[model samples]
Structures are given as C-alpha cells and as structure tokens.
Target: MVPFSLTAAHGSIHASTKQVGCQPLASKGLNHTEQQAGEFRSSRRLVLLLGIASASSLQRPASATPYKEAENIQYGLSNGNIRPCPGGYNPNCVSTASLNDLYSPVWRSSLTSIATSAQVLDSAVMQSSDKAQIVIKRSMPNAEYLEYEVPGLFGRDFMEFLIKADKGAGGAGEENSEGAIVLYRSIAGNVKYLYPFQTAISDFGAQRKRLEAIRQTLGWRKLGCDLKECFE
Candidate 1:
C-alpha cells in the first residue's frame, strides 16, 4: 500500500499527493503502426516529465524546517469540533463544521499569563505610548483576521480580554486622558500582518521560554534557552 499524503482545502475532501501532482496514464503501450508509435512514445515522455516535475514540487522536503506552532496547529474538518480563536468582548465560539478550534481553554490561559507578564514588563520599561501597543494575529485556512485597536495597549490587553474576559489587568495610565470614548474598537480592515506579527510575538523571550517549557513537559522536541534568565 502506498502512503498517502493529504492536503485539505475549505470544506473539500482531502486531496492526495497523487491527485495534486500526478496525471493518469493509459495502461496500453504504443500501437502497431510505426508512425503512430513514435508519436505515442513522445507523448508518453512529455506526460512523464510533467508528472515528475509536479510530484517533485509537491513532495515535502525532508530537510524543511518544522513549522514553529505545530503543537498549537489545529486541523480544520468539515464535520468536526471547532473551537475557533475567540475574538474580543463578543467572542464567536462555535463547535460546528467548516471550523476547527485552534485556541483552546488552556491556550487562552497561556494568553492570560503572557498578557499579565507583558503588562508587568511594560510597567518596568515602558517610556512611551508608542511602545505600549499590543498586536494580535489569527491564522486559518484562508486569510480571516480580526484585530482590536485599544489605547495604551500594554501587556496582553489584546489576547486576554479577547480570549478570557478582563482576566488581564490594565490601567488608563496616560491613555485615558486623551480619549473620552471607550478605547476598544474592532478595526474592520484586512489583516496584512498575520505572519510577520506572529513572528514578532513569538520572538519575545518570555513566550519562547513558555513554549519551550510546554514542549519539554509534553516530551516533544526540546529547545534550549540562551538567555540566562529564561533558562533559570
């Protein structure tokens, strides 16, 4: 039996690697006619070359680096449980098909921890409102993004309230004086920063430490912390 590599699309049956990269060929060989025989062989060679190229492209490189968030990666099924990445105050939590829950209760808890930690760190070092902005990014099969623009967005303000209401502590500090309006606003705009922003968030040393600890506890592949504080 051939091992099947599956790739999925929106609400569609998983496509096998063959279907993605190979074409079916007639079993019959070149016929009796000499003139037709040459043409048949040429056609077969062309088809074979195309198929090879396609297959090569589809093959996952053995040396390819692993996706950083494989543990947090959620598989979306057309008919399976989906606890989607929750949004702010009005979270749209659903366990229906066409969705897969990426953010779980535990994941939300982690977000809360990071948020509190972020706020604490900010208080210690923050000197400008510009450095206080909190950014959030969500990834899925397609590009579906939701962002919240809050003033004086320090710490985990974006993740905590969105995932677990008011679990994150916040102070008006200097942001409140400038605004008479409720600071939170669902900025209805295209999410262009999903990938890079996620990278930025992941680069934070504290997050990397938490991820390393979680991975180690799970007995998955472990990572080393170069920073003295993180290792301790």
Candidate 2:
C-alpha cells in the first residue's frame, strides 16, 4: 500500500552570490568530484554573502514614520507641591533643578517675579508654540506646577514649570523664591523605532536652544554655570 500526504512549505533563499561574481556549477564543464567541490565552495560563498547582508541590514539606521497627532496621550503632573524632578527621572527628560545630578539648574528667580515672567512666556508660547494643545495647573502650599504640551515631530513634548516660594537655608527672603522648568520629549509609535540615541541628542540640543531663547527673551539670569557644562 502507498500513502499520500500534502504539506505546504514557505521560506525564502536569497542567492546573492551570483551578483558578487560567483558562477553556477551546472554551467561549467567539469568532472563529478570537481563539480561537487565547486558546488561546496559556491554554497559556502552564498552563506557568507547572506550573512554579510543580514549584518548590514541590522546596522542600517531606522527611519521616522508618519506621526498622527490625534493618538498622543498627555500625562498630568503628580499631586503636591513642586519638587525636584516632579515626574521622576527619564533619559528623555531635562529639568531646571539638579535631580540625582542628572538635570541642570535653570534661571532662578522669585516666585512673584517668575509668575510675572510666566505670563509673558504663556503669551509667547500660545502664539508661536509648536504643537501645543493642553495646559494643566497645580498649586501647592509652597510651590506650583504648570505643565503643558508642545508639538513634536513624532509625538507630543511635555513642558513644565515649577515655582517655589519657600525660604532659603539661611531663612533669608532673598533666596526664598525660586523657579524652574523642564522639557520632556515623548518618543512614541514609529518615532522610537526610527530615531536612535544620536537623533535624540540632536533633538535635545535644539530644544535647549529654543528654551534658552525664551529665557533670554524674559531677561532671566542663568543661575548656574555655563549651559554647556550642564550637558553630560
């Protein structure tokens, strides 16, 4: 008795050796043993070529995909007064205060003065802000947190301002008032896959420049050393 069965196989074999000057054994006139040796060499060459192609593909950079603004999700600030690194530490996050030495200090001013400056910033941001949509406000006993969204290439970027009116260590009114800001670039969907660490660093530089311009426009003084020293 004979048994019959049907099965389907699916696979792909990329024969790139031919493109690299490798010749087929069947087309050459040779003895059986010579032909076998040639075939083995050809197989080895094909395997090597396939391996190279795979490595190159993996090393290739990722590309940014189209972004849909409607799909973005914005998170609200945490409860309580403003603290150092309100939303915690993130690689894509930058803040005015030093958080675990990860963030750099921004211009420090009085809460009242900063509040006045915020009005100007709000107006400027409202008029020329990139992809900004939502704004959330929170007031605590000694501080305030203002969070907003800015349009990003792939997803929405978060911008936050923290204002503190507590007294300084010396109990002096001069240092009681302080303000800070932070920017968080959100990488979502295809953007994360396409943009590498280098691209993210570039984005951070550009955003810092924009923020610096705003700070200058408000006539805010830099509290720490040079901005360049803040970067890691």
Top model by lDDT, which number? 2
**lDDT, candidates in the order shown:** 0.29, 0.46
Best by TM-score: 2
Put down candidate 1 lDDT per residue, 1-232, tens digits, no spaces: 1113212221122233223223333434333474356556555655565565567557575542222332232323223123233222112222111123322222212222333423332332223224334444343321112232323212232212121122233552222221111001111111112353332122223322333343233222211323443322
Give me candidate 2's TM-score against the actual structure: 0.45
Candidate 1, which ten residues in sequence have the lowest lDDT sum? 179-188
Off by over 4 Å in 2: 1-91, 97-102, 110-114, 127-131, 169-191, 194-204, 225-232
List, residue by residue over 72-112, the lDDT tens digit for candidate 2: 33344445422333222123444544355335455554234
- Taking all chains together, each candidate's TM-score versus the true structure is 0.18, 0.45
For model 2, what is the alpha-carbon lDDT of residue 69? 26
lDDT (C-alpha) at residue 47 in model 1: 58
